[model samples]
Target: MNHFPPLRLLVTFEALSRHGSMRDAAARLNVTQPAVSQAIKALEDYIGVRLIDRSVRPSRMTEEGELLARAVREGLGRISATLEDIRAMQTDADRQITVACTLGVATYWLMPRLSGFYDRHPEITVNVQAPASDLPVLSPGVDIALRYGTGGWREGINGKLFDEIVCPVGSPDLVARLMEDGVDLDTAPLIHVRNPHNQHWAGWEDYLAVKGITRPRSSGQSFNNYVQAMQAVIDGRGLMLGWRSITERAVLEGTLTEWPNGTHDLGTAYYVSTGVDPSKDALLFTQWLREEAT
Candidate 1:
């Protein structure tokens, strides 16, 4: 028989070590400070060493405590990762392929055309997850990802999805209103999409600099994702750099209008990236995506 302290105690200790305060750890764990302190004390007693020095304003881990904490953190992280792998396996067992993509491409571009894929391949289902800011990990469950970039993703076979050309886009009514108000295109507020990974996607400066237009104005509302940025433009908030492949449907529907003749290549393209040994379904999906884009 094996006897061990509760995993909760290790978790509590790890949280306490990370946050440096019982209250903060408690808040994170959704437990009382006393509970966190008791867990730490119990863990210390089990190890037969003073795990943390509680004398300071924010408690500091002793040398022994740091070593133990590091082991516990690594162990817990591995356990969590293993459990996620198991879950992913289960998800795959259900014959579903998961995809990660940006909201702009998913909502404005992919979703509208997904019915055709479903109709053609009814045996396979797709699960789409779009994290607001962070890129999704290409793991066992996620068969493929459509990422917006310069095709520079590591650890994957990348294929071009489509070239994205960004130019000023706004609602026709909003453009008319701006024109009526005498807001010069140079001085108009630019809606910036704040993508941390691709800062060039944010504004006219990079786009225009590449095209030899050096004096594009830079000031306005910024959003973290495409959905919010496009929404703001749709709501007459301001003019935003729009990708035609993603925003074309809206443009055709008259909800958005492209400014200055509607075309300028942003020098970047979306790519379909996959981990090593992608399944047959994943390959088929990738092929379908390429065909659809073209």
Candidate 2:
């Protein structure tokens, strides 16, 4: 029998190491802070080494901890991939494909035009998984992913979709209300997108600074996902930093309007990568997506 700690304990420790905070790790694992601590202690007892250095303010992993953490990440990743391969064998061939992307892209962008693909090929079922991060790992079951970056993901075959452009956008009513009320744009209530991987998505600070408009970072609602933030904007709650890939359709449809400031051409672009061996349906969907972008 394997004498290592329980898999759950190792999983919890991995989360804690990844987040660098017990509370944040617990949040990711859906457990309490004390539970995280207990799990770490249990793992330490099993491994006979202190995984965490409690002396640090943010509680970092010790050298021994780093070694174990690396091993766990790699081991779990391999195990997960093997399980996915087994599941795929049980599943019907070429009937199902999964696409992974951020919630905003899935909601405002891809979901709007998904029916077109289905109309052409009704046999394939596209499973869209919109996780919190724009750059999520393309695990076993996921056939493809749409990520925003400089196109160097070795996980699969990747290609650039298009260069990204971002700007301030809001509902027509909200802009009109702010104008009528003579509210200062800088101090006005605005939407903010907060994420652990903040670099992937541009925020108000980057937008305002590029436009030479100084503004306070603290304003209106802050949502962890753009789906909620954009919804808040549609409800006229506040204006949000918007990107072409996610907000262009909404603006063109008159559901949203761009503010006076010009757009920012983020040198980086969005990219799409596919699994090692994608199904014919997956390839068709990818080709359709590429043609649509042009």
**Quick one: best lDDT, which candidate?**
2
The sequence of per-residue lDDT tens digits that candidate 2 reaches over residues 168-196 is 88999988777788875577788898988
Those runs of model 2 whose alpha carbons end farther than 4 Å from true positions after fitting are: 1-91, 179-184, 197-199
Kindly give the number of clashing pairs for every candidate: 0, 0
Clashing pairs in 1: none
Please give the lDDT score at residue 220 for candidate 2. Answer: 68
Note the Cα lDDT for every prediction shown.
0.81, 0.84
- Clash list (residue pairs), candidate 2: none
Q: Which window of ten consecutive residues has the lowest lDDT sum in model 1?
A: 209-218
lDDT of 1 by residue, 1-294 (tens): 165778888899989878878899999999998999889999989878899887975678999999988998898999999999999778767577889887777898888989999999988888888766546557656889887768777788888888877778898988887778887656777788776765545466765566565453546787777788888999988888888766789989999988756477757788899988888888888989999989
